[model samples]
Target: MWKPILLILLMIFIGVVGFHIIEGWPFLDCLYMTIITIFTVGFKEVKNLSPQGRIFTIFIILGGVGTAIFTLTKLGEILYEGGINRFLRRRKMEKKLKSLKNHYIICGHGRMGKTVRERLEEEKLPFVVVDNNEKKLLELKQTYRCLYIEGDAAQEEVLNKAGIKKAKGLAALLSSDADNLYLVLTVKLINPSLFVLSKAMDEEAERKILQVGANKVVSPYKLSGLKIAQGLIRPTLVDFMDLIIRRKELSLYMEEFTVKRDSDIVNRNLSECDIRRTTNVIVVAMKKPGEDIVFNPSPDIKVETGDTLLVLGDKEAIDHFEKSYLGGIS
Candidate 1:
């Protein structure tokens, strides 16, 4: 594009200089004559041309017209190719977005949003990212090959494009608390049942965000401060948590499973399930509906339908336990 444009400009300068030197016309008249001749506007000459001037004008016409045509052709080709490619990519993206169901929607592509995306991806959860910044979205797509929508996350249209209606949950991690607040409100209005998690910079923002509709609010600074304090007080405990939660080199994993109403474990006690012996998974805690979580639940406690169990074990053990006892993946 630049090469062709520069060639056209060079041709014009040659024409202008040639007319000024050959015909002794003023700079302005020479410019007018050059533009008219090059463009084939068929306008009358600024003044009668000398033999030498007419010869110069002919050469100028040939070079200028040829360059202009070349430039136009290149411009047209670029526009056509770019337009078609964009159309096809958007069509493919829309098709994929529509096909998604029970997926998570992540708003913003900043630090918090990126962290959320990575964690979800690590867990093998299906999700789509939304961001108003095209550059950031493109970078993410290139790096992770993940699905994303380029638009303001706070807007209903953008959320709808991200399949907000069918999404199981959404995370609002926009740069500003105000943006996240608006996003949560918009999301709740569209799908009140959809769970929303948002980030806030301060307690005030967290309060407002919760009031708006966010199911949970997190503050990075507050969490960081607490982690630092905990590290100072109980470094060993933090290291243990990091080992399992980060899953760097350890095989241990923590996962939650819901007790289906029809499962065999539903009316039985923990010990009766023989989960540890059978699948090598430890029942860490249990949370019954409308009740606080019970840590290290007693083996004698009876399991009931709709109870959620937080278990800790290796991936294979958890998968086996979930499949053999809990039916299958939820």
Candidate 2:
């Protein structure tokens, strides 16, 4: 791909230097003559050439013209093989993102945001990324069949293109806390029910995010410190949870499901709901809207409308449970 281009450049340089030396022409005139001779554009020379310059023109035409043709052909092949296909593929991907529903919108492709995207993809979750960096998005496409949009995430048009109104959640992991906060505010203003988790650079940003209706705010540095402490204090528990979290490699996984207002099992106690008997899935905890999560929810705890159930079980069991009873996870 590159060799032909380099050779063409070398040929042009030789032609310019030759004309300047043999014909005593200025650099600009020499360059113009070289271009015309190489492309066979049928333009007369800027000045009459010396006998030596005429001889030099013959060699320049031989080397430069052939090399130029080869370079053009190679470029044409490259465009046909890769560039055109990539453009068509991007158009197809945009259509998919525009039609997505109950999906996630990830804003940013920096380190933290990329990590979040990888985990979501590993779990087979549907999501489309929004970032202003087309190069980074291109790199991501080379590795994964991920959908993305190139635009400023803070803009309403970009968010709408990502289908933010129908999105289940938004992960605002922009490079700066201020940008993430602004994104969270914009998203929530447009879709108040959409869950938003954002990254914060400082305590003030964290407070502002929630003030703007972000459902959760994360400080990656703080989480790293807490994780290091937990690793030392409770290694066994962390390792066990890690196994359950590896959805692609492990059959057992942990997920949350919502109880609809009209579910038949609503207002019934956990014992009577008999989730374990029917689906073989364990309910690890349950949280009502605006309430604290009840860890290891007691058997007497009633399954109520608007309760979120965090369960751990095999894939088949969880699917069966979702199909039979759970409304959908928010």
Writing each residue's lDDT as its tens digit, candidate 1 over 1-330 gives 588878888888999898888888899999999999888899899899999998998898888888888988998878766786667766887789999989999999887788888888887888999998877787765554678988899888889989999999999999899999999999999999998999999899999999988989999999999999999999999899888888877899998887998787889999999999999999999999889999999999999999999999999999999988888867
What candidate 2 gets wrong by more than 4 Å, as runs, is 5-73, 81-83, 141-144, 327-330
Q: Model 2 compared with the native: what TM-score?
A: 0.77
Error of 1 at 80 (Å): 7.9
Per-residue error for 218 in candidate 2, Å, reads: 1.2
What is candidate 2's local distance difference test score? 0.87
lDDT of every predicted structure (CA atoms): 0.89, 0.87
> What would the per-residue lDDT of candidate 2 be over residues 1-330, giving only the tens digit for each residue?
899889888888998999999988899999999999998998998999889999999998888888889999999989976889778887788789878998988899888778888898887889999899878787777864788888999999999999988998999988888898888888888899999999898988899999999999998888889888998999988778778776555788798878888776789998987899999999999999889999899999888888999998998898888877765433
Clashes of each: 0, 0
